[model samples]
Target: MTTITKDNITDSLLATVHPNGNSEAAQVIRENGFPTTKHEEYKFTNITKRIESKIQSFQQAKPLGLTQQDVSKAMIKDLDADVVVFNNGQFSAELSSLGEGYAVTNVTNSEAPFSIKDLYDDSYLALNKASFEKGVFIQIPKNKVLDKPVLLLNLVKANDGQLITPKLWIDCAENTEAVFIEQTVSQDEQAYLLNGSVEIKTASNSHIHYYRVQNQNNEALEVNNLLTDIHRDSTFTSFVLSLEGDMIRNNVTLNLLDSGCEGNMYGLYLLGGKTHVDNHTNVDHTKPHSESNELYKGVLADTSRGVFNGKIFVREDAQKTNAFQQNNNILLSDEATINTKPQLEIWADDVKCSHGCTTGQLDEEALFYLQARGIDKKQGKALLLYAFAGDVLEHLKIEAFKEYCIDLVQKKLGTNF
Candidate 1:
């Protein structure tokens, strides 16, 4: 007889399940040390602590709200897009609506390109895959121009210690174009954890603009991954807006697989009170003639903590690659904390790559200048913070969404601009 151990639980949790959530796959991941207790990718973040607390297992045997009509009525007002809604890791077709530009389907009939099994040796990811529940599959056909953005919204409501695992796979075909927006919010204050994954595949000459707005409840725990594969001449861009949540960690990775592939990343996070936000990004150049650029900025107040870890890798054969990454942070309160690491690993001598990171208090002169113009100290501080974050929001393609980000920042920082 074979053994079924906690390691399988770890694999099921990270979401690389086999054709289904296979129990044996979990064992393989555990044996490989990918489920390390001290891996760098999970450094400073406590995963074992969550397990020690006996968090409840996630189940999707029954559906929540899943319907086009339900989604249109419950989601953020004025939001325009084809939407897939997940309530506690299960697809809710009734609570979600589809936008005009794309087609949305439940992944029950299909398989993901990469599963919790393929991409993770990390114990946490394995744990997710072993037990991944419901998922959403988005297909943007070849050469089709999406009429509207596609939105994926997740709501977590629990009676007790439940885990929510939601998976998403987005495929943009050749010469196709689409914009995807993902948002997570909760209707109740529950001590829940959301471990989710989003995988995007962009064909040659196509373009994808993706955004993640994390506005979950302060008591919720969120761990999410956004992974993308870019082919020849394709472009991928990301805008991440994080404001609420007691503990939130987001990992975004982009693989430039062919020549002329381009990746553009911009993000802003504002944390206040005791909230915690961590953003990690990676851009991998596998072929020559590729390019990537990243800029992430953050503002923290009260005793909040913000972390940024960005890595760029250029292979030996990836000559003529151009990659740039920068991280900037502003602290408003004495107890606020910011940790930043920007790294570059280049094997090709002919490639041009540069990375830099900075963290500090708000510009004193800028605040003083605004205050001298009859703005109160509070207002002046908020203005400076807004201006700092607005730079990232500018990358947003939708006018309303950009405005929403600015307004969210202002509200969280305590003075509207």
Candidate 2:
């Protein structure tokens, strides 16, 4: 039995994980210890239990190895995009596509200028900093615009349990515009634990579109964290789509440091078969004249569960701020459950902030009306669910991607249209 106690993890890291030398991050993880459900931020998710369940399986998994063909089936078909592939937590330059106006390099060769101080009060981030074996740094220079989107494909090939950590640091320079899509997949019906983190900074006047697409097999579990900082006149937009997974949690934090900044967050989760998904988001407005918008919707079937916690904060000095948040969920089965909480804190007298949350079963009246119009009951239900999620899909600027999401939703509902 491979147990992850304080002494055992510390000894293992010192001996094998970081034989070159134990980093400060490892020490921090050891000191703070692993988190439990007692932690308020993770109240609905039991991370410790999840980790323990896979410790032995991870130890017996196949070694890290993958080929392009193993991942080709999961890729977006016929999409013209710059691709960056990571096989079992390690970057694969041979399978990636690089373009001009940006640089992508390994963290080790690029000095890995990440400081533990940057990740304040987040133990998982500290642990990632200490344990990650492979990381990538993406830089886009000033006044540059990427004509095509960049796709980051992370393929997990472990049949048994495996611990995979992939970190990304992206810096968008002044007056630049770019788009990044991150996709997660499994080579087969594998079981694994993924602790992933991405840190993003947007310079003044920069615009970025970030997409997180999770389509893993039912056996995988993941904890993903995203931290972002936006400067004056910058815009940051995030779209998260969680289609399938056994247990998945997303923690996103955005800080607007200067005036005239904007942030938008949109997420859609479709879960079934005892699947669990949780999303926690925080938008902080520290300066005057900042705006933020957030909306997340989910569909739950069978015994699946969904959770959404979104908070928006306006500092005392942040006058002229506007913030809005909304979370909605629909349950298709009697056993399905959803928990949603939308919060707003405004210390500024001249700021506008509001939040709302809704969770309920499908509208019976609407279903009846659709069935009356020559549509079968099952197809009618699927149509209504599609309409509920269409708003979020329409927000996607990429036409091909939007259609792809639509297809996935239809397939999940056992319908074709």
RMSD per candidate (Å) reads: 3.8, 2.8
Q: Which window of 10 residues has the lowest lDDT sum in candidate 1? A: 1-10
* lDDT to native, each model: 0.74, 0.80
Q: Which predicted model would earn the best TM-score?
A: 2
Q: How do the residues 1-417 of candidate 2 rate in per-residue lDDT, one tens digit apiece?
A: 144653354343223233332366667666766567897777887765665664443332223566667667667876678888887766789878778779998875126644323424555666566567658999999999999888888877665436677878899999999988899878778677777888899999999999988889888888888889999999999999998888898988889999999999999999888889999998999999999999999999889889898888899999999999999988888998888888888889998888998888888999999989899988888888988987988778776677777788788775422
lDDT of 1 at 186: 76
Candidate 1's displacement at residue 187, Å, is: 1.4
Task: State which candidate has the highest lDDT.
Answer: 2
The per-candidate count of clashes, in order, stands at 38, 1
State the TM-score for model 1: 0.88
- TM values, all candidates: 0.88, 0.92
